[model samples]
Target: MTVFISPLIPVVIAVAALVIAVIKDYRIGTLIVVILAFTNVGGQQIFEAYHVFLLIIMLTAFSLTLAVLRGSVAVQGIKEFNILLAIFGTWSFLSGVIAIDHELWFGMIEYMIRAFLVLYLVYNSFSKGEEIFRLFKIIVFSMFLSSIISFFAMIGSLSLSVETLLSLFSTRFAGTIVDPNFYAMTIAGIIPLAFVLITEEKRIALKAFWIISVFFLMLTIVFSQSRTGIIAISIIFIYSLYNLMRKKRVEILFFIIPIIVILILIPPAFWFRMSVFVESLSSGARADTSVVHRLLLLRSALDVFLKNPIFGVGLGNFEAIAGRYTIDPMVCHNTYLEIASNLGLLGTVPFVLLLYRGFMLPKHSMQNPNVRELSWAVRTGLLGMYVAILFLSVPFKLDLWILLSIAAILGRKISSEKSP
Candidate 1:
């Protein structure tokens, strides 16, 4: 019952809203999307494996049936890239079918369930521009709230139940995330929303809260000392500000000035942690040395790739091959390498193309001012995600997988528009 306000509910509700809105008022359906965006990232889910997957299955079946009955096979905004990723994802899915290791194949296909949902959201997103704006507001508010908690947790202020469990032994800014880097990566994506919120949200109370969230979230990133999250934040900040400028949003100086001022007043300790990570990435080379241990992980993965290069070793079998290397098996931290290592050229190409086209479509759609606001906001957020994942990790979380599925739905829209 207490979980009713849980952050993750908004995302699924948004998906459901799209279905309902598609039948009647897309604007109403669009409200669900907004709620999910705001409530997107918080804590990990309690029930794992089957329960979550079952929900995804139900959503997919329902969405597909609704779309087909409507003759469009999608809500109003369904784009071509959505279908392409689904199709490409299927190839990846098929590779799982022929995968050498039983467990890994099952896991790879399991992950794609979220991909399907993202496509659903995107299909619905294209329904109306006002809804997109509304969703962006929700995304901003959620980020603001989460950032504040994370900041306090990092600085020795507000303590959360999740933090107590994760750092019961150690004091780090893992926050709502299971890993410090993952936490950092997720927050990094929030930077764009924060900037956008400060621009669009004129109410003084909202502005005060938004400003506070930014300061603290930045503080968490600093102490957690995640290089990727920090870097991604910088990139997103610059990119978003550029977008605002392009749109000529310079009139909001009264609001923007105070927020900018607050961001600059961060404690020096934050920079100290960041400096150390930079040192580690460059001449420090300690993290690299530790990464060297992954050589063993990579070699073992390569052995599997050699045997299954056409389809490769399959989606989830990276760990199975680890038996030849060491007793305790693990993930290859470099997701791109792991995918290539497991799935081979044959399996990896289609998936990459789907991402490539999905990312590109928003840029093509940005010429229209209304379309630009909605499309670029997501794209800018994605740009942060792209940057963060490269340094932090790949798409492993339920939230991330679900977001990808929404991207696919958007991809379908682009594909349809570009099609003959």
Candidate 2:
């Protein structure tokens, strides 16, 4: 019962308190708003998995429209996202309108709706910056608790009543989300937040606590052995260490570690992931057992592109189209190939712009120490996600979609305050 409720209860009470506070006092609403956004992330994503977030998105549109019409451009970050979503949505409809493949059209609309909701949270959440920070603190606090429970559960250190409920492999150790890879990636993503917070943390004990959390998070990351999780963590660590040791020599050390990782650690795993891949490239079609399967899927997608050329096959039609070329019904694990094959250059280009811009904007984000400091956690995690994508065909996941939307909204929020 303790493990069952450990993850859920505090946030629930925080939400109730937040709503009550918002009704009773406007100042409290600030924190409430942030609390709401922070708590909502995994929940909404999980809800969406069950197809509920779609209904919620429609309701949100109505609610948000009321807010917008009242001249409450109060959430400029959300506003920019709406703008981008509009572009994305408009193009989505264009795909439906022009798409020869019908399934792709339906998929595009579904993708757009979810994108909008994610944008909404990001946009509005920033309006409560201090609250976001507070909620972040709360989240880190909660994560710490989760870690503590998980740690003892590991070594037979405690024979707690909830011990049976805790299984590190499937359930117990998840930071917030239950999936180990997602947990690692998300934790890695937020390291910048901790890094930023540590700079402001005055209490010696609190500072030590946050530092310890980093160690715990890294341990789990390595434990997960999800290639992307490790890669993402490494990327964030480099960024964090660079910030910590500002001297040129320290920066070089950051770069040097990766060389050692590649030389020492990555070879075995990389070779394992690439064994069939290297063989396939060398001898042509003989080796089909490895990550080369994904590469094969890419070639099939390219063939579909060549055939359709203009609009290509259609969203989700890669299965259908690829089957026409190969007996096996395979999906393109490569996003670029999938996008071009399905929607062709037209449907895929603008969305690519959205990603390109989001990825590019972080460099500019580094300009201000405050924004950098504040956003670095998310940014660091993003850097990891970026590096991870080279190995996994994961960018198309709504996980990334949600992440990218939040980031864009935050960047817009920060930029808006700077402009005026």
Candidate 3:
């Protein structure tokens, strides 16, 4: 059926693109990776079994490794964070082996492959500041493209009548990205990038372009109607306001006015959705149905962690085994709880350390003013993503890895410049 095979379209296109890019020139791999990052947000859904982004990462790694070994490309020093990542990935795979349920083991293995490749390839890809700048261009362009798609999709869906309006608000704008929340998160993640670009660029035309881009990106987030997305935008804006107040007070208007416009233009349904959060808090614990389900899911994850405290119920086994604990089956919505449930304390420690190290490097990169400023944006974006994962199980999403790649590359660049 067309419905069943629709997902294959992205897979085939990605495969062809990867093949051509590799055959034409190895440097094209970076471009393809950028495409994969953008596509993964909402584009990968075309293929039900499509792990093309992972494939692209693996291929790029293999090609880059061959180039290095053959002396065609200079070898960059491996960072400690990458080694820690490898160790954690190995542990994750081992944990999967002892999993109580094997139905989803393959999917877990696939994710481990993608995560490892992202850590290794991103760290190795950029050896110079210029390369990082090029990557940044790709990121900015991708965000722009994604935001445009989201805005248009929302417009196309809008219709007359309260019935139509209600349905529109009920449905989130997916755009090229399949899931509304993920699309919104992607747009939200790019908010800081738009802000940084708006500040850093000197040209009046360019600044105006970024301003328009930022407005629509904000609109896309609003249209997606995701609480996580809204919170992510709030986080970015707060970070922006704090940074701007300290450094560039006059320019804060570029950010503040658009944020106010977005809040004012938001539909009644979105406001109601947001009110649920406030209402849930006021009503006491587990009062909201959605919040109650999440709490129950968290409890179920904790139960799994307690039962399998060492190796875990196993990777991908949480949903299968969690049914015993909860009336309805659910994946671990919280990333921390999911990691704890899947890998237990033994694996969770290294995994947490990997994330910590990833974060701290960016924090330390503040030595370079440019790196510091950009890192602030990247850090806030990653934080937003982490917040998002608290509501959705997206451990292997390519956009998160791309953000990590950017953080790792910036941190490494800073470290490399520290000379003997």
Candidate 4:
């Protein structure tokens, strides 16, 4: 009865699970990678430094090795989009070589490479409709887990009350991502996937799970106090509402009930934060320092773009030279502006084309009846993400790349089904 187990036993079990994941299905390994990448667990200090990166490398290598053994490792799906990404990557590398800040450039390049690898792995590893659906479920589950973490974090940090909420206007619930805006946007982007799952799942228990997950996810956004996240989620909700009304009219309760609960739970402080945008528009006075700062950053980015219209000041050099144009000396808060100011037309053109290709994938896939719902989900999710990034300068965000790859994989599955 007093027999004890070694601590290494847990490690051994984990290794065994990982080996099974790699050998049984590369999709499982890829899903593990996605969960790690999205949760930002590997970046945390509790683990050894860069442990997440090592896990990613090992999982990716194992998955690719399995693909080779099964004769399934081939460059496939979204050829045109891949080409555009390649061109963009090449241009960024060339631009980075002459960057005003080599340190920043190196860091950016490293992130870019990792994001690209995730996209490549996901697109090639998944081909079947079931596989794609499973991927979507796993992604939504990961976000749901993140939302739970944020809920507890908020609870532990401060007592919940209207007065306390008002006093903590600056407090943002970031969950594990560490950045409130990005965390909020990430949750908003996954909401569509959750909605799709809700519509597809016939089991009451599972449907309820998704509904509760959505409620908590929305609550996290309100706590984040991110204006951009609010806008993005509003767009997604409107889209999902339209889709639900057209088809799943009865299931509308599943969507509406959670939203009502969130509306009730949302604090006055959130509305006050959101009101700044309205106040600025109505009065043409930038009372909010954050809004004013972002506008100044926007103007400076435009100025940089105009000054270096072809190749830009150089990749990741915008912040280094930002002080020359504006007092902020910060990277532009807008993703489009960040790219336009950093890479200019040479990089911007291919990058825009790549996004267009991603959109087109889901647009085209909607024609196939079997995959229509899934395609709609991907399109809506991508739309939310694209909108969210307008105010966030994150060109190398892992989630964006993963979503684009999902679109490509869905499109490829549709085409293969249509083939004779």
What local lDDT score does residue 336 receive in model 2, on the 0 to 100 scale?
A: 65
Better of 1 and 2 by lDDT: 1
Worst 10 residues of 2 by lDDT: 30-39
RMSD of 3: 5.1
Report the C-alpha lDDT of model 2 over 234-334, residue by residue, as the tens digit.
66666767766774444344335433543453335434534546667687545755445666778888887877776756565676666665566666756
lDDT of 1: 0.56
Best-performing candidate as measured by lDDT: 4
- Per residue, candidate 1 scores C-alpha lDDT tens digits across 1-420 of 364577878988986675565455433333443333334332334345345444534554465556568776445533544465655566677776666687767765655654455445445544344434455556556655665675555556536677664553245566645577777776666555565555556699977776666666666665565656767777876776665678687634533553475357534655655565566556665445434445556666666677667676667767667777767677665565567666687656765665566566566556554345446556666677777765432644444443444444333333323211
Cα lDDT of candidate 3 equals: 0.72
Runs with alpha carbons beyond 4 Å of true place in candidate 1: 1-45, 48-79, 97-100, 146-170, 202-204, 238-290, 294-309, 323-328, 396-420
The model with the greater lDDT, 2 or 4, is 4
**On a 0 to 100 scale, what is the lDDT of residue 204 in model 4?**
99
Best by TM-score: 4
Q: What lDDT is reached at residue 141 by model 4?
A: 89
Question: Candidates 2 and 3: which is better by lDDT?
Answer: 3
Of the two candidates 3 and 4, the one with more favorable TM-score, higher being better, is 4
Q: Candidate 4 — what's its lDDT?
A: 0.78
For each candidate, C-alpha RMSD in Å?
Answer: 7.3, 7.1, 5.1, 3.4
Which runs in model 2 stand beyond 4 Å of their true positions? Answer: 1-49, 52-84, 97-108, 128-132, 135-188, 236-290, 325-330, 362-365, 391-406, 415-420
